[model samples]
Target chain A: MKKIIMEKEAGRFCENKDIAKKLREEIIEPTIREKEPVIIDFGNVSGATQSFIHALVSNVIREYRDQAFDNLLYKNACLEIQKIISIVYNYMQLD
Target chain B: MDEKWVNVNPAQLALTAALALKVGKENAIIQSQNIPLSARYLDRMGLYNFFSTPSPFRQYRKKEPAGRFVPISIIKNGDDQSKFVTDIIPLYHLSEKNSRILSYIVGELVRNVLEHSFSEDGAVVAAQYYKESNRISFAICDTGIGLWKSLQIWHPKTDKEALSLALTPGVTGTTLELGGTSENGGAGLFFIKSIVKISRSYFVIMSGDSEYTLLKTRPDIKNRLYSDPFKDHYAFSNSISRFNGTLVAVDLKLDSTPEFQKLLDDIGDIYDSAVKESRRKPARKPKFI
Candidate 1:
């Protein structure tokens, strides 16, 4: 299992898509490809923009589909973060 | 700028700052002499710092911008964006709940400029809290490629068309696909517009020769979120003097702000429905045979 701490990567407010893209490309994608469950921890993060959340996980959801959902875990996300993540999941899954 | 009495909002201030940067210090000048007392707000907002021409008015003691306003700032990269978001909440004297909404708007708008504007000078941002109105107003502008140019791959024939597509829920300049690519969902502006709408406030976007303004929703009327911006009450003009880059300004009424999670739920529902509806293949017309 691979753990990604959002605060360490994106600060308390995760709005930077560059950092998000980096996390996806460098960490999330590789772990998901290996079929290892990945946990994205948002413990200290206070809020996130929809764009940042979109960049971070939209592609993984697109590529992995059901497996991505089954293996990917979001821990300690605030309500705002969860809504944003859920929004991205819903839209991306529409395809 | 030499008007006898000048009154401008944060949007105008940021736009002027962007114009100053574009004209360069040598060509741009501000005449401070003969200015009205009200013009002091200009200096207070740090507009003078952008100009090479010195202020003719005597300098006043500087005050910390705690709980009132954020002066003109240039944000060039992600680090600057993060720091600005962190620092802005206290400046507005916003509560933790209120701060999230402001942070989200600022973050998405500034990030749009950084990622797409292609302006070396980055984004010029300014904001003020209107104590009388119980609202916050802010603007972000860039001298980089404007919306028309940025959306060129989509073959937008005019600036107005580009602005329309840019405001749509799922369309993006980055891709022709419905859901958009990983890095861009093209929903930033839409979400911002929705937030402003829900608050019954105004949101404006300008680029090239065109501008679109989301008019304040009437308090007496039912508020409905629309995936298509034009469906809402709005004003538009293609005749505005051409601006080479993009500028967006928002007025958020703090008092009217719904709970943060509730706002998200509302926006998320609209967004999901919009995307899902777009992807739904139109029902084939009944056979005429």
Candidate 2:
């Protein structure tokens, strides 16, 4: 199991979907393929928009299915980021 | 007062009044032939302690701040826009979540001004926070080619039609041949509309000869994420006068509980549905409000 601090990989502000897609491919994919529990830390990330989180989470969920939740962990999310994650997660659950 | 000031356009009137108040000369007798759009907006926006005299065009101003209108200089680039967010957040004591929302909105709107407006002078933005009323108002104006003319190069549309289409997602005037990037998803107005609707904010957009005003009617929590297309929540009308550029005004409740999670959920759902509708095997057109 390994932890990925988003602010360390990206910057304090993560708003672009293209950057989110890149992060998922570069960091999250390898971790998932190795079957390691990946804890994604959002500490020090000032803010994130719906586009970025949607791209990062949806792409992984599309590939890994419902099991993505089991292999992944989210941490250090402020109220703002937490809200964004909740929205993305709910939409992913929808039909 | 010069007679020319009497017949000034809405933008000029608004700017003149703002400058007057800024310079601490709120009381000034104005003589005009008719009540301009600017005066009407000033009355509606609750700016300055002023009243029209017995004559329709003549008004007397009193030096008092009727509204907490914050004066913002022209925002030409990202740095200026960021300064606006920083200034506004502290002025309103906005929650961190609300600050983020404002940043996203202002950032996107200003970016459009820089990228699409082709305005030699750039854009102007202003804000007002009504603490007692628990509301905040923001306005952005750009003296560029209006939406109708800008979009006409791609599709021939009336002023009203151009304004309507501008609010739709993935409806960009920039074509692939024009070197627009894939990220040019044309979602700026879409996101703005959605956010304003969800937050129950009053939104008014005027460009050229057309204007659209939307009064928020939904509750903070609603059964649907988007507004009813046929509802009277919005109105599209032709104005008596034309603006050479675009002006957007928004009035939002400051007391809003930041239900950002739900808002984000709605945005995600809308985007997903839009994508699916476009790529469906059977071929289907996406529905937009």
Candidate 3:
């Protein structure tokens, strides 16, 4: 299992699309390919935009389909972050 | 065409010059008592170069500067874009919650330029905090393919119709990939509109050859579209204009937590109702036709 700390990767503001892409590529994609469970740790990150969460989580859901749920873990997400993640995840499922 | 000097408000003059330059009408040769002043202001802000000769009182232009009212800044790429939201907005002395709301509103508008404007020179952002008026005004502008051209991929639309669809949630002009930095949900303007609607913001979107303005007043009626009580706030207009690309301007009341929270709660309620409705509807059995 690989633990990816979002605050370390994207700093305090995890709201940029390109930064989200870098996070997805560096951590999520590689871990998912190895069929290893990846823990996305949002320990100190403050807030995120829908676009950023969409890039980080939905793109993977698009690639791995339903299996993304099994291979990924969200850790230490604040209430706001959890809400955004749920919105993006649910929106992606609609598509 | 004839050249004439028109008397207009300073802000209107600025918008006229900016729109003229945006639509490739820089050489139209019309002037105003305030147009020259507006020109000098835009020139300093790096918005338009409508004037060939510098203002006579160049020292005043330099000493006072245009940022007094219109704090204009150009955002070229992603780095400036992020810094503008996370860093610059907090300097205005707003509450944390207010900062977040402004950040979301401004971020969404500017992100639209990054994702869809496709302008070579990038987008321009301008904002003003009117302390006396208890409001903040700002605009995000781009010189790329206009809304009509972008949404033509989905279907042919007049500039007015394009503005309508752009404000409608789940409607996108292009087939953007599901996710990856780009704004994929097509909810940028929709969210901003809802925010403005709740916060009693005066909002305007100018693109192609049409402009749309929504003015909020007397909080009586619900905004049917967003399911929020934006009632008695129904000063909406769709007019013909010659602006190219897209320009979104907003003047929202400062510190509107109640309105903003109501918007969020409304969205959550709608989402819950949708899920419950979907669960209630039974799946249909497959039948040969």
Candidate 4:
């Protein structure tokens, strides 16, 4: 398993608005370079809105279509984060 | 319209909220409007839920025939506020941001009703995002302590004042009741208001006899200016109530309309009768200053 640790040291996860643009450079691009699975640790992440998660997951899914999110699950991930993501993904598929 | 809808009930709301959290807004909506649910969740609480109390069990469920506007039956005499919204609400532009505004607003509203009013039951909340119609709506109703008794903790005289004060964003009856992060009230309403303003949505709040409404013309207002915090602006209304509680409906508009003022007046009328009826019963009267 190829593991990459991306730190949201800012503690202002909600602050990342250019999430697609930011991750395109910072995380997703780097991960695709190695072409390996990744685990996003939302352990110390302060908080986030559903839009932020959509920018993250949808961008990744855009790169690799038909990719499931739990495939990269963080077992100890915050329930709040999961709930937010679940709502977004659920609604996104509607459109 | 691609599909038909059933009029919504309270049980349908729980299923809709969960389903909207699972499927896309459209499919979840098509599944059912007056969506019924299995009683497993309600049995846990043991409270007699009037809205959810299933009538005679149907011999079989009437499955949607598929590909017609699901005829939504009007559920009368029930607090199906959120269910109405969930049945026809649209949040395409805000995406999940709208949901955040709603969830936070609701969490705060629910907690307030339960804690301050000592409401013995839980309120049912529902929402929907209709892209085709370009609107979103949500309604919430509860069977317990109405607006007056809930805010009576801080403002002892009247339910209208209690109702007005609660809508004044950041009303922290939370701290006083729950010993949470805040001591006086919950800041949730304040935050919810800001989000609603930012979304440029139509927000109407009803508690007891008072109704408060706000609309944001500029979607980019928050980014444009530094803002003041939420204040209980409706205190000016002088509206009072004798009812046991409240029902609030929020709608987001996709396009500007000339009927804006009419919308506010129409909602104002919704509670006119309820508030009047509540006051008629010679309960504990309020002495206004």
Candidate 5:
């Protein structure tokens, strides 16, 4: 039941697929292994380019698509950022 | 008095410069760096004119040079403009070097206005016709979300300091992946500064709140020293608005030849591309009108 919270950056948010990939390896991989829930924060991190958000969110959704879903969750994504991610998630068929 | 505006949202200032050269009064070719001119635009020597056309203004394409001052403007909208100057350069009988110089200057001006900008009026353009010698000037004005608005994104500093950084290559306001600033680090305008130093044509640039004018001090071209000030004054418009419209000024020499005359269409393409770059509702060049 470890709650991992990744803080948000300014409006720019984090970019580069490499960063997203690294987070996948360290955070998502371990969380799934232990079946613990993860909550990422977007309190300060305002929003990010469509491409950057796509890279990160898609990765998590695909990895835990069907089996033991809802084990990992993203919390605190700004209203704008969350809205965009939700739209993209549906577009990606992760609903 | 008989000359009427023949454009459909010309590329702002480039078309104006070409038309100025084609005016066929003094038969002089002129060029201006890519930057917005003040509201003063094209007023000079009891001659005042304004409009925005296409660049690389040519009076005659093959034989004799074009007329005195061919009015040209950019007829554009926003950033992401792909070297439309390429289409117009060949007609000028300019070497790659010459084409690069003109395009580079224009690139600097147009890119800045397009990338870091926001305007309530959509886009802005203006040119002046110098009645006496028929030197129609080119200029585009915008309420750019000024350098300060841009800097607010990352840095904290004075408007002047922000402006200085603006020309510092790669110093654009566009976010990454959105084809952010200066692919080569926003060096477009910076490179223009040096090339202009060697040009025998009139070159001036005013970005953000800073102004750089070079009329008399230019390198020799074809053993001819080119230096003529179209206008040396700051222009302000919608001073209260956040605009990024940029004005370009240049007096082109349109040699009396049909080839140069044909350039009107070439300039047309440049304007067409502006609409695409800015991602605005597609618009046509003023020429067809």
Candidate 6:
């Protein structure tokens, strides 16, 4: 399993898409390709933008479909962050 | 320009700041003489800082901005954006719940500038809290490619058309795909507009020679979110003096704000349906034998 701590890279508010892109390219995509589970920890992240959340995970969801949902996990997300995550997930999964 | 009285909102102030930056400090000049007493608010808002010309008003003690306003600031990159978001909440004395809404707006708008606008001068931003109205008004302006230019890939014929597409849910300059590219969902402006709409506030966007303003929702009107921007009560003009960049301003009533999570849930649902509906295939015409 691969663990990525969001606060360490994105500070308290995770709104930087550059960092999101980097994490997706460097960590999330690689781990998912290896067929290993990945956990993205949002501990200490007070808030996040829908764009930030979208940039971070939308590609994985697009490429991997069900495996991405089953293998990827979000940890310590506040209600706001969870809503944003769900928004991205729903729209991206829509046919 | 000199007037007997001066009144301006955060959006106007941010635009002035951006213009000053664009004109360069040496070329930029503010008429300092015979300035109205009401113009002191301009000085307080830090407008003079961007100009090489001296401030017309006499120097006063610098006051702390907490619980009142955030003076004009320039956000050039991600680091600057993050720091601004962190520092702005205390400046407004906003509670955690309130801060989330403001942060979300700032984050999405400024990031739009950094990633899409391509303005080396970056985004000029300012905010003010009104005690009487119990609301906050903020604006972001960039001296980069305007909406028409940004949406050229999608073939927006005019600035007005570009503004319309920009506010449409899930339509982004990055890609024509239904869900948008991985990096952009094209939902930032739509989300911001919905928040302001539900709060019964005003939202405005200007680019090139066109501008679109979402008029304040009347109390008697039922609050409804629309995927099409023009369906809402609004004022639009295509004859405004051409501006080479983009400006977005919003007035959000703090008192009227619904719970942040609930607001998102409602907006999310509307956004999903809009995307799904857009992707729906058209019904086939009856076949002629």
Instruction: Give the whole-model CA lDDT for all candidates, comma-separated.
Output: 0.89, 0.62, 0.65, 0.42, 0.39, 0.89
- Show pairs that collide, candidate 3: B221-B231
Interface RMSD of each: 1.0, 6.7, 4.1, 18.7, 16.8, 1.0
Lowest lDDT 10-residue stretch of candidate 6 chain B: B272-281
**TM agreement with the true structure for every prediction:** 0.95, 0.62, 0.78, 0.41, 0.35, 0.95
lDDT of 4 by residue, B91-205 (tens): 2234433433443444444444444544333454544444576665555545456666655546646655665455442234533322112112233343344445544666655
Off by over 4 Å in 2: A1-42, A49-95, B1-68, B153-156, B176-180, B218-232, B275-289
List native contact recovery per candidate, as a fraction of 1: 0.83, 0.14, 0.20, 0.00, 0.00, 0.77
- Residue-by-residue lDDT tens digits, candidate 3, B1-289: 1133323322343354455445554454444444544344445544444434343445553534332344456677778888887667767767766777777777677778887888765667777666787787888777788898878865745777777667655556766333222336665676677668667667888887777777774467554334221222444445555666778888888755444455655554454333334234388999999
Cα-based lDDT at residue B163, candidate 3: 76
- The clash number for model 5 is 89
Model 6 regions more than 4 Å off: B1-4, B279-289
lDDT of 1 by residue, B193-216 (tens): 999999899999999999999999
True contacts kept of 6: 0.77
Better of 4 and 5 by lDDT: 4
Q: Which ten residues in a row have the lowest lDDT in candidate 4 chain B?
A: B177-186
Candidate 5 local lDDT, B1-289, one digit each (tens): 1133222222334333333433432544333454232222232211123323232333323322122222333334422123233333344454433333344344445544554555333223333333454322334445445566765654736544554454342234544212232121233343343233333234344444454444434233222111111221223222222223233344322211112112222222322232223323357757864
Please provide, for model 5 over A1-95, each residue's C-alpha lDDT reduced to its tens digit, 9 standing for 90 to 100.
Answer: 54444442212333233444556667766777677776666666534433345445555555566432477566776554555455435433412
**By lDDT, highest first, what's the ranking?**
6, 1, 3, 2, 4, 5
Error of 5 at A26 (Å): 30
Q: Compared with the true structure, what per-residue lDDT tens digits does model 6 show for residues B52-166? A: 8777777767667887888999999988998898876757778777888899899999999998898989999999999998899999999999999898877988898899889
Preferred candidate (TM-score higher): 1 or 5: 1
The CA-based lDDT of model 3 is what?
Answer: 0.65
lDDT digits (tens) for residues B200-219 of candidate 2: 77777788888888777667
DockQ for all models: 0.82, 0.14, 0.33, 0.03, 0.02, 0.80
